[model samples]
Target: MRHAGQRPADMPGAAGFRAAKWHTPIGTSRPSSRVLPSPARVRGPGPAARADRAQGPDRGASVTDLATMSLQQEIARDLQVSASFDAQEEIERRVAFLAGQLTSTGLRSLVLGISGGVDSLTAGRLCQLAVERVRAAGREAEFFAMRLPYGDQADEKDAQQALEFIRPDRVLTVDVKPASDAALQAALAGGTEFRDAHHQDFVHGNIKARQRMIAQYAVAGAHEGLVVGTDHAAEAVSGFFTKFGDGAADVVPLTGLTKRRVRAVAQALGAPSALVLKTPTADLETLNPGRPDEDALGVTYDDIDDFLEGKAVGEAAFEAIARRYRLTEHKRRPPIAP
Candidate 1:
């Protein structure tokens, strides 16, 4: 299954690939496969190496080459590791631990919003599995999956696919548009001087997210269930989620996992391929129609996952990620007290 020029560890050239000392310049063009290095292997030049590189062009070029090669190797290694996991074992352990957390709260059930997206689908499936384990142990547990669409989600079919797979104890559908509209109307009702520009799509999207949480908490209140969230390490790191909106949850089972890991978990849990492979979308604004999550992120999930997994990223990717992580620090923190 190795692609062209990609050798296995036991293959003839792989040893050289691993041990070979690259002597090319920093910006030398390499095959796509070898352009990035394993993060573990990317290390700073030792004192002697740095001294040698400073001596002359030949040594400096070679040092730069080694650094570049290390970066490429690190990235490739991260990618390889990302695709491999102990799916069943991980799933079982996560479910058991999450079930313990849920039961510890004395809640009768777990309620979560299912968008038919991979994150929610994976979290929902994990919750269902946890509830099943709870019941098997003769404890009372149930799962509530809510479908919250702003108006009409184009990807409702994906949600259906997820529901068919997860099959929670109860399914609830609530359109958050009315509340969203009411909030927007109330905000701009006074017709302030800046009313026109104040109510942007992102503003409305935040309202939708908060409204959805309201619906979720409403159901959780009646059923004595805790709200579960789908936020994972990837979104949590980048602060890609809305505050007090999708981010509000009693238990986040999928925390500390990157998006790539989430997908692997979904596949292990038998999520439908269509839902698993579907491009992730926020479904927030109607103006863009189908603005992808990556569009708002300013980077692809692949880059985010790689960066989050500690892979050595390119300069541009690193800067973009760092900027985002820095700016979104507020989103991940509690409000400042006077």
Candidate 2:
């Protein structure tokens, strides 16, 4: 008994959606939907296309079209991606914002995990700057740059570099592998087997992420501080974070900026060029360790940044991005209330 002429479960467009293919962009498992041919792929008129539909496709786009697009044209994206800002001004604003958070909440510290990635590294630097500003204002605040690694992370050297750049008040390390592996062992002992090795690796990867966050929260709680996350518009477009793990944060200073914009802020913060431009990756899966984020997304950050920044992108890139944004809406939202 199909409701509303539902297609079979195995069908490409089943479940009321086209079931856009994923290269596991969000650092999670690929969606369960079976392979759908590219040509047969439904080209979702991307954000620009959707926006154009609202006010006659023939009309040229307004300069601020993206910032002011109607709800229907913009529902997929979580934030409006601005083109650029004065890097120093953005930095000062973010530092001041962080300082405000501390002053208003009276929290003694800002705790963030430093993964040696641009996002975390920038946020860590900002956190240090913010705490310093708070202290200058006759208040006490500390920035704790935590290293919650899964045993020995492949990027320890980069992490050290980030630490040197951030110069946080204190640096702490918590090896999350022991705890993460324990959970996996328990699940296996209880007769739980994932679909395959990659599936198991993906699940364990999420465990690692959650454990890392657990460490951050514990440290934050001990010092009466807030957990900071590195989420920004570029990553947000694909929801490229583990839910409740890296995703759950008390504050995100890097919100609404794209990857390139984040790098600009990093430069303003005096980050070394090498660390600022490292290829982004979730680096989660043991099966495909250190997978480049571009590989996972099936699109490049350049394309993502362009689409997010309201520049024209090829149809394929646009569809891939819009699809991820649509699929991962749940990651960005709070739990639904009755």
Candidate 3:
């Protein structure tokens, strides 16, 4: 099997979907109309029906209205219950602890791919804290933040923000356009027809992610440092990441936390409020206004994480996630022997 750092000849260009912060659609926590029964009366007529009609349509409608109200109330109650269980504090502590552990591993320095997303931001912060702890102990610790862009100006902007936040020993920017274009041309030459908008998006998005991963690993090797991954539990659970792409990391600081909790940890760590509040985007498309990742994946991160944690995933949702997860589980694991 090809190692995570190696880019295959047929690999497409760097144009993966951008990461964006999530905003739950309006009324997501509320009961939907599907929960309510139809207000229309039954057309069928019979003596038994007529006898049962003593309750009248008004009574039935009233009952349904009450039931609908109760359903909404119940949904609200459940949401509150779920909200109460957010693992923000726990995740933050874990990340902080992980940072200490990494330093104790006798590593000289830390390197990370700073994408300006919550995951990367959280990882960067933890690395900074870890370096500080190591410095306090009279040990040498360094942080390098690399900004790898694939012909995207927005990526430059995000990288700049990350640079300002982390203030690493050195900030490096590598342009992957040459490699990306080569792969894209190869894909076109192979006569791989782009079927629709979705297919095109998928192909392009995977290319960008894989390219970034390749660049990150190359830098890690040159610096003799571990490559930090920004993947979170939500993305991992739904297999939303590209294999050997963003999934390639020497150390994953936030893999155990959900997207929602990741945001909270970022906020708690004094990350820029804007960075915490901004919608997550992978910054793959510099020209086009980026779409939310969940929109592209057709499911919310909250639902994905819930299912991964052994909560109820409906039959349809369960099958969808299960298949994707099984296929992508390889991305989450170390390389196996043949």
Per-candidate TM-score against the hidden true structure: 0.74, 0.79, 0.65
Ranking by lDDT: 2, 1, 3
RMSD in Å for model 1: 15.2
| Residue-by-residue lDDT tens digits, candidate 1, 152-245 | 8887787888899998999989999999999878877866232233225546766787789899889989988878877665665455565567
Best-fitting candidate, scored by lDDT? 2
Each candidate's lDDT (Cα)?
0.61, 0.67, 0.53
> What does candidate 2's lDDT look like per residue over 113-149, in tens digits?
8888899999899999999999998988899999888
Error of 1 at 317 (Å): 0.3
Count the clashes in each prediction: 12, 0, 16
lDDT of 2 at 140: 83
Give the alpha carbon lDDT tens digit for every residue of 59-131 in model 3.
1111123433343233333222233444555554555665565565767667777777667777787777767
- What RMSD, rounded to one decimal, does every model reach? 15.2, 10.2, 13.6
Report the error of model 3 at residue 97, Å: 4.6
